[model samples]
Target: MIGKKKTDATMILSSEDTRLGPSFVEREEVYTPCYCEENVWKLFERLARDEDEWYAVVISNPSRTAVVLEQRAGSAENGGLVIWDYHVIAFRAIGGKADLVLDLDTRLSFPTPASTYFSRTFLPLDLLRQQFGEVFLKVVEAKQYVREFSSDRSHMRLPDGRWQSPPPDYPCILAPDGVGRFEEQMSITSEDVARRREARGWGTVLTLEEFRDRFL
Candidate 1:
C-alpha cells in the first residue's frame, strides 16, 4: 500500500528500429489477479488491435518502489519476490525477434524473453535498496497506451474505503474528456507529471539499462 500516484516520467521511449510482427496466442483466461494496469490493458488491447505495435512499460521507483524477481507472488526461498508499487509491463518487437516481455503478473512465460525477462526480473541496481537505486522507466506507445490511458481505481483504495487488492472486474479507464490523469498516466516523476511526451507530443523517459540496450 505504498502507492502515491504511479509514475509516467513523460513516458515515450521508442526510437524505432522495426518493431511488430509476431505473437498472438492468448487464451489462458486473460489473467487479472492484482491487476497490473488492467493486465496491461488487456495485453494492450489484443496486441494493439492487430499489430499497431508494442511497448507500454512502467516500472517505478521514485520511492514508490518495486522489487519483482521471479515472482508469482512471493515465497519459495525468496524465489518469487514481489514488492511492487508500480509495475505495468508490455513489450513486443519484431524484425529479428527476442523482445517479448508481456507480464501478466509474471510467473514467467506469457511472453518472457527480453533477455529472459530482464535477466530473471530486475534486481541488481547495486543489490537494491537506496530508494530502489534508480529503476524508473515509462515507455509508452502501445497504440499510445490505447489512446492515453486512464484509471480511477483510486490507487486501489484503502483507508476506510476498503479494497487494497481484489479489484479489476472491469470498468475504470477513462480520461479523454479533458486529457490524461490517472496520476498523470501512472507517474515515475517530473514533479507532478504534466503528461509530457514533450507536452503530449508523444512520450520520453528511460532507464532500466536505457531500455534493455534497445534490444538485448
Candidate 2:
C-alpha cells in the first residue's frame, strides 16, 4: 500500500464525523482525491478531515472488469489521497499496510470485504437496464450471482441498450417480502428507475441479489 500522512492544509472536519465515530465516512469523502466533473470527492474529504481515518480509492469500470486501487493516509497531504490504475479482478493487499483493499465502483452498493473502507455507489441493476439498454446486462455477465438467479444461467444482455431484462422469471425476486417479483419487475421503466425510489414507494430501489443476501 502507498502510505500518506495528513497535511494540515487539506483536511475539512465535520460534526457527522463525531457522531458516527470511526465509521463516519460519507460517500463523498473518498471521492475528493479523484478528478471528476462533479465534486463528489469533496464529500469524502470532509469526512476524512472530521474523523481522522485513512481511506482507499478504487476507480472502476465493471463493464471492462477493470479497477485501480490507491491508498490515502488520513494525516497526509492532499487529504492523503492516492490514485492507482491497474487491471486487477479481485481484492488484494498492498505493502501490508491496510488489513484489506476494497474495489469501489461508485455505481454499485455492494458489500466489500472486511478490513477495508471501500467507496461504491449503488446503481440499481434494474435502472442500469433502463439506461444502457443492451450494455447494462454486461454487468451481470461480468459477475456471478449467488441468490438472485434461481438457475445456473451464466449470462444475459439488456435490450435496446436502454433497459436490462430481469432474469426471465426472476424480475420480482429482488423485491422486499410481500412484494411480488413480477409486479416489481413490471413497475420499473426505462424512464423512471433512477429517480428517488421513496417517491415511487418502491422498497430501497433495486439491489443486487448477491449483496442483499450476503451470498458473495
Q: Number of the top candidate by lDDT?
A: 1
What digit string (tens of lDDT, one per residue) describes model 1 on residues 1-216? 232111111213343522333445352445566667667777667665455447777777566667877766667697777777778888776753436676766666555657778888888877774545566677777777778777777777878999877776667767668443666666677542334234243355666666666546
Model 1's number of clashes is 11
Evaluate residue 39 in candidate 2 and report its C-alpha lDDT on the 0 to 100 scale. 23
TM-score of each: 0.30, 0.20
- Candidate 2 residue lDDT tens string, 39-153: 2222332333342322322222223222222333222343323332211112222232322222322222212332323323223456534653211110111112112212121
Model 1 bad stretches (over 4 Å): 1-35, 38-53, 56-69, 76-78, 81-88, 96-112, 118-141, 144-148, 162-173, 178-216
Q: What is the C-alpha lDDT of each candidate?
A: 0.64, 0.26
How many clashes in each candidate? 11, 24
Each prediction's RMSD to truth: 16.7, 17.4
The worst-scoring run of ten residues by lDDT in candidate 1 lies at: 3-12
Question: How many angstroms is residue 196 displaced in model 2 relative to the true structure, after the best TM-score fit?
Answer: 43
